[model samples]
Target chain A: MNTPEPFLGATSHTPVRHHILSVLVENKAGVLARVAGLFARRGFNIYSLAVAPAETKARFSRITIVVDAESAPLEQIVEQLDKLVNVVAISDIAPKDALERELLLATIKTDVDNRTSLLDVVGNYGAAIVDVDAGSVTLMLAGTPAACDELERELESYTTLELHRTGRVALPRLGKAAVAADPD
Target chain B: MGGLFLYLTKRIIVQLTGAQALIKSLEMEGVEVIFGLPGGAILPVYDPLIDSSVRHVLVRHEQGAGHMAEGYALATGRPGVAMVTSGPGATNIVTPIGNAHMDSTPLVVITGQVSSAAIGTDAFQECDITGITMGITKHNFLVKSAHEIPRAVAAAFHIATTGRPGPVLVDVPKDIAQSMMEWWYPASIEELDLPGYHPVVDLDADRVAQAIELIRVAERPVLYVGGGTLKSHASAQLLAFAERTGMPVVTTLMARGAFPDSHAQHLGMPGMHGMYAAVTAIQKCDLLISLGARFDDRVTGKIPAFAPHAKVIHVDIDKAEFNKVRRADVAIRSNVAAVLEAWDANQASPQNLEVWWKEINAWRETYPLVYDEPAVEGLLRPQHVIESIAKAAAPGTIVTSGVGQHQMWASQFWKFEEPGTWINSGGAGTMGFGVPAAIGAKAGRPDRVVWCIDGDGCFQMTAQELVTARSEGIPIKVAILNNAYLGMVRQWQEMFYDERYSEVYLSPDLPDYVKWAESMGCVGLRATNIEEMHAAIATANTINDVPVVIDFRTDSSEKVFPMVAAGASNDDIMVHPLQREQS
Candidate 1:
């Protein structure tokens, strides 16, 4: 397992790439505000965020924050967050980790006959056809935003359908020890 | 002998004017003790403190002194004074100063500057302290002359304590501190026309009524109270509004105890670190009334989904915050108290959203705030310790908490009778906040019992302040939830990651807490069981001259339940020890 870097830095070693921050919090009011306040106050450019209570308790919830900043500030983001009153802990799950970040995109297609072809394209990206009707077909995709975007690009070949996507949601491989801070 | 006396008189004259003026000004504003550490440049200021009646607590570190002053100011509802020397000494206090700015604690920080001639030169121990602290301070000054010291000190107190209370800095040059001048205390503060400061809490009542009307029509209504509620001292109004309307209240981290925790209408804190109950309630509610709060993103995760079903009514003194995130459906730009009073008198029906309340409450009961029944049965349960503290606390007593398991437990177990009774560094989540905040809270209401509930990890971070508490004679009762490690991080390592103790586990040879407290001239209580805790609390309650510490050896494995796993929806709640898989 790769040890996570300390969540504080002046610059990222790597080039620009979309980063996702998944946070677990007490399921309470103003918790979102508290979290968002952290990001905004610290000037963390959060592209998107999705929150819901975990399966554990009503007082606990999970939040996935999407960003595209240098890796340098990510550490500061995490370290500063450890001080949040409602945050239990923060972990920057690396992309290589056994994790699944999922999203569902529903779109209305005008081309009925070409729907099978669109379904086939989505299938390649691990999405499945969830609904079928006269004018539109809704496809459910579970993967990274890149995967969903690729499917959406493929679907565009057939009548560029109406589309809706749930923000990114992820789950790490459970029962694994969290990677400690890298001493290097 | 006559020649020696003449030289001594001249030396003392220069020192008496600058330092004496600052001391006189602070005392006039009712400041008794200033928390700080000394350096060469600040020695002259320290000189008058020796002869002056005002007491001074010489803190071990300058940063701790700043935090202590912040805590004292927060507790007493008066401006807290913190003194430090040049460069690192002044820089060390920056964090607490910034904290005061964010949380709006009234504080006056006096830092010793290099001699006036070395102001901008790369002199020894020199720094642009004022420029560095500009963003965090309400106002700042560099006392170039001895006469400016009195005016600057007076101005700092006024700015720090009025309106939106925050930290103000007065950098006194070394030469100025040694100069002589007539000490002048302003007869009244009414003459200062502060450019940005608004002394009165004037709010448009008509606009507030419009906000109430919007709430009356909202099907699923939610109330969000922010730090402004605490700043405005509008706890009564906030509580009354939530109770009368049967609306679930969500408090920002800075506004933790703005609403009573025990209120059935309380939905808990919302945002990223917020409870699931609050997020769900906010997401599903039709109308959200934000009082004394800015719609910070933490509360409105993915703004589109934040209170997706609701139209937001925002009430705040800062107009810039209006629609800054989730746009307000009805905006009342006013002081919290004034707006609430106006809303209370308005013509509107209390919109009944019983069905909505039922749905949210159902979600709450299924995922109640409970941990696995004490993994180790013999250990003193953290909950029991918290409950006993609550039981023993006098009515309207104030409780402050540090960031960790202890804070969560306090939120779950402590039954708050009124708003503003509970204080914590919610938004900033500053560790070691409890002791200082408790000191502040105790100073705020002298008659009330102030309980500083802390985790051992957090307590130890700023334990040096026990000296400040002792020296000041502020009788704050500290309940240390000693889990023997960074309990919260350890829990994460246990559940999400494999159990790798790493650096999270604390050492066995811990500092002698009892001896430490005693050394500071404060009482200490160590409770390995429930009985001992009760006895300790009772004994501590009887002592008024000093503070107390109660060490509770809690179960290390216990967890805060009802968790939302990372990156999950508000509906996907992990109810402790069990999963409430369905919404």
Candidate 2:
């Protein structure tokens, strides 16, 4: 008689270090389910997850996952990622090589008619006014995933009825390129 | 004597480099033969292989080699190995690789990759084989250097065979394959921390005692076996427990051959297509002892109604599977053999529920599994086709099936006399798995009959397999239960979709699958009626040169009953002969 245990064994191990993994996956329905299922099945804690289309053609998507692990099982993660059928490749980029791993936020309508103070708050945060219609102004800001979230929290009091936020996206530093060695 | 010893030692060290070391590494890993296709990327390895003791069976297609390797591994309880070249050659094996991964079959797939220089440049015959196979395999490797080959091979074998067995791929660059290096077999595995690798073999004493007490106090108990039993090779331990407790046992589809069919205590498969007696027993029993079985939806029916009267005790090697669906009174995370051995030491006779057994026996007699009069009038019944195959299929024959009505019928009618005789994608429920799995099975056990049973829809999905089968000269018989439609979906729509027939009718006209088979250099036959079915079977049985597809059209309206509706629990089974539609 075999007894079943937790899919992810005992939770006794000390938390290693937090790892931020950016993934490029084929855009498809249930892709998230497949990825999430693998993490659940393997028993990995996902501190944060953000997703968006990587390419405008909608063929590829980017998923940013922040995991609390001492040493990430990168090989196993890549191995278990069968859910993303169209995933062409996966790589872990050094944090320093990230030029812009950030999210963009835009609030269309704000009660700047009565609260002119909201405009000052947006300006203080180095946010841009993308559109100004009637008495309200549309503010836009781009920053790191956490920084963008922080700025939004402070802007919540400005009657922020409509808000649009872009999930985390990143590009390698200008000089960095991955190339395979030439065949002799 | 000293001079000879020195000479031998020096020669052994020299032989450990280049292709010689590769052959020795494979031999050390216990790889007896390789099923593969040869190409430029892999010529160096094969050249050395020709001089080595290892055997290689050249297959027509790379995919066939993968299937053959998987089959050999399933048959021998060892990892099956397949080798191939880059690009199409490597990509062709993806389907079988996925098959092994889903079925938990141990397989080793070694592909020759393009030289490192052509890897990302997309040069002639170059492909990202490692990337392509990543998800389908449990693990994968790209041998960047010759020194890494032996260690990578060792690790691949270890991972592929340990814990939950699955396929692993190692793509060796062409240059690396030809390079010479000082080969030192990695003496031990580095402690790669796998979260789920719990090495403790003993069952928790407290849990075991609790379960024993529960069993002793229970009035009625039934034991359920699952695929894990066969996977762990724990049939003997399970049999001992059954005899000791006089417990009635049933199995899941993947666990079909776990118990002898003739055993008096056997209750048959339980779930959607389970036996009437088995379903009723699961529903009515006061205590359920499950061994190495996952409570898959097909088995549990509707969760709330499944085993409502019973206190479940689920035993499985996977910790996450325990109480994941059905809450168990006692759940143990240990190997089947280990737990059963532990239980044997602390054995106690349980109180007998004589009346319950009598009732179960009465149900079995009254609802004895019978077919619809053998379709003697005109039509071919799927049941008849299965029975005919079973009669023709030799003992220890390999039966693989694709999903749908035909799969269920084959599982029910085929009397598997031994473990590992039946193979299918049970958990994944993948259609088109039959023919390839059969290909794999035959490659493993060349002397045994490998029958591929599929529904018309399922057969058409991977019918391309005929090319591989014919070219490989593996005599696997393909039996198609053609009902002229998606029978399972049609049945569902008939019962639930208001009988609209919607798009379920596969009636644009079947493009002479027989001709299609012949075009692929394989034999094909059609069974329009009962008499012709016999003829088709005869034809299939006689052909030993190539794979044959026998298309047998049957009545589409027939439903696989004694089904416990999804989530309805085991007791609320809807038996065939319609007691009335679900309210």
Candidate 3:
């Protein structure tokens, strides 16, 4: 029997990095399920996903999906998503060529002794203390996904009572900056 | 709102309830027939259907209705329509929906839902059909209001018929079906506000040129045709392309009739249970020009080892299919007909395939499809029955089959010379597909004769549909190869599992097929030997007013030879023991 060789197609290789796919879809009932169900059925890994109404009219919802490229091919992901009837457009935003942001809200356990130090750490990351109670303080940060990750790491020193994060959202960078960064 | 105001001012507003609007929409789409059953949730829609131009054939089960719709679509190029009530009715049709999705058949399935207030409350006959069928359908619509009926129907038909055609579903709530609204139908698909749906129709020049360049330089080439060619109605173009290139063309199971079986350049079906020459030619070819054929696991065996020496040029209407399995050296995302038309215009001299044809011819001559006589003195072979039926049927007879050993025998023995003449559950391989599909095909093409080659196990699954045929005045012929066991499973158990047989046996005489046919108002006959089989077939051909069923008692021990075991390389294909011994 002849041993089979590994296929060397575009779908065969596993990417080492994450892919952020911004999809615009019709604002209809079960549209989100259709998009998410496609991913689950096709076995595509979703790291994070956030959806919100795009523009003022709310005719369409923009879905920001961060996919683990190691599980599914990028080309296949786009092609499959494009097949959905509600999906209007899909843009794969590269890390450098796009502006990415995420929002983090954390309630940290703090006392008099560590309150100043926690405030200093929060200040260093440019995070704001939205509310301050006797035992805990609530902080909010809206920044780059990497920045949010760093701030979350710094807050790990203190006890985190509760933490919440809005998944990353992205758009292609405009003007000459995006043009210069084009790998093509 | 502005468009509604303009329509109201420009034309007289005709007030109609949602059910009436739905039926009127089907009429506007020129739907000639619908296969369905009425229930509590769908009764309102049925009331309107009585007065509409669309003829409704009441099916015994929702599964039969779905398969009949699929058969109608497969026989005719038009999208088949099927309607059913909520819950079990919707769930029963999921198998055929998945089958249509896999085979890329154009089907528009409508399922009734509980009233708007009853949805999500687990009311009687309530189920989230749209959610259940999301993965299987090309797209689906859930009409919340009466006003959305016309647009939803229009969109469902458009999505089902265009691009890589597959099943699309519309789930209408019972309350929505009863609510009154002004009737307004969209003039065209463009007016339906579907910006996301666009099927690629034009061929990319660069890819075509690259494929042509490969064809020019390749010493050995094969034209691998698939169901997409038939879907695109490109059989003529494919025939011309094959003749011009002088390449050996191998049609897959779904594509049996896309190219004439009698054509000299044709190499028969390919893959597991495929012809020895056709499978060997693909394995040894240097250039593989795949048209509308996906590299399904059944055809590829072990994917990495399949056509290892070939540089594949894959063409399909669906872009996602390009690199889904085998990578294409040149990928053309367009209709198969468009690509063939483009390639036909850029005419080049045919390549010299003398050495290739000589090798393939030798294989064909050495391992021609052969079966030995049954060990029992008077037992009939299933293959012989299929051959006899094929010989007796008229030139343009349509053949449908249930999945199993019988389906393979029918595909192997029948000589198909035109497109849309062969319909079967190719992708999903759903059993009990033959009877309902044959009925649907006969209903679609009343002028042509339709024959269903079914297995006993498969016949029992949806045999109730024969009643639908009799009551609806559609005449079809069914030849049940009654081996008394699930022959394919028995073969696998014998070959790989130490012949335990397990529960594969279904007693030959339990139901009495002749009595069952008579119960369903069909003429039933029985055959045990070749002479009896011939006589049965001859009697079946003569009955034009009523459907006929013939029970052929065949030897259960026979297996489909020229086999490639599951997950094995194509190089390890096993010929029949008799043929091997002769060679």
Please report the candidate that would top DockQ against the real structure.
Answer: 3
Cα deviation of B537 in candidate 3 (Å)?
Answer: 0.9
Q: Give each model's whole-structure lDDT.
A: 0.72, 0.74, 0.89
Residues B1-583 of candidate 1 have per-residue lDDT tens digits of 9999888776333334687777777777788778889997787888778877776877777777877777666656567888999998999888788877777788899999999988889788899887777656766777778876766777788777665577888999999988888655565664442322444445666666777677777778778888888888898987776666677787766677678777778877776556767877877878778887766654565555556677778887655456556667787666788777776666344557789878988867765555445433466778788887788777887888888878877876776656557777655567887887677566556788888889888888888777777776777888888878898888778877888877898742387677777787888778776677778878877877788887777878777665555545545545555454443
Misplaced by over 4 Å in model 2 are A1-37, A40-45, A48-184, B1-11, B15-24, B38-63, B87-91, B117-136, B187-200, B463-473, B502-525, B535-549, B565-571, B578-583
How well does candidate 2 score on lDDT at residue B33?
76
User: How closely does chain A match the true chain A in each prediction, as TM-score?
Assistant: 0.74, 0.59, 0.85
TM-scores vs. true structure, each candidate: 0.69, 0.73, 0.95
DockQ of 2: 0.04
Instruction: Score residue B473 of candidate 2 by CA lDDT.
Output: 75
Q: Which candidate is the best by TM-score?
A: 3
Provide per-model DockQ scores. 0.01, 0.04, 0.41
User: Would you list the rank order by TM-score, best first?
Assistant: 3, 2, 1
Q: What is the lDDT of residue A149 in candidate 2?
A: 63
Model 3 misplacement above 4 A: A1-15, A176-184, B1-10, B374-376
How many clashing residue pairs are found in candidate 1? Answer: 81
Backbone collisions counted per model: 81, 27, 0
Give me the candidate number with maximum lDDT: 3
- Model 1 chain B: worst 10 consecutive residues (lDDT sum): B190-199
lDDT of model 2 at position B97: 90
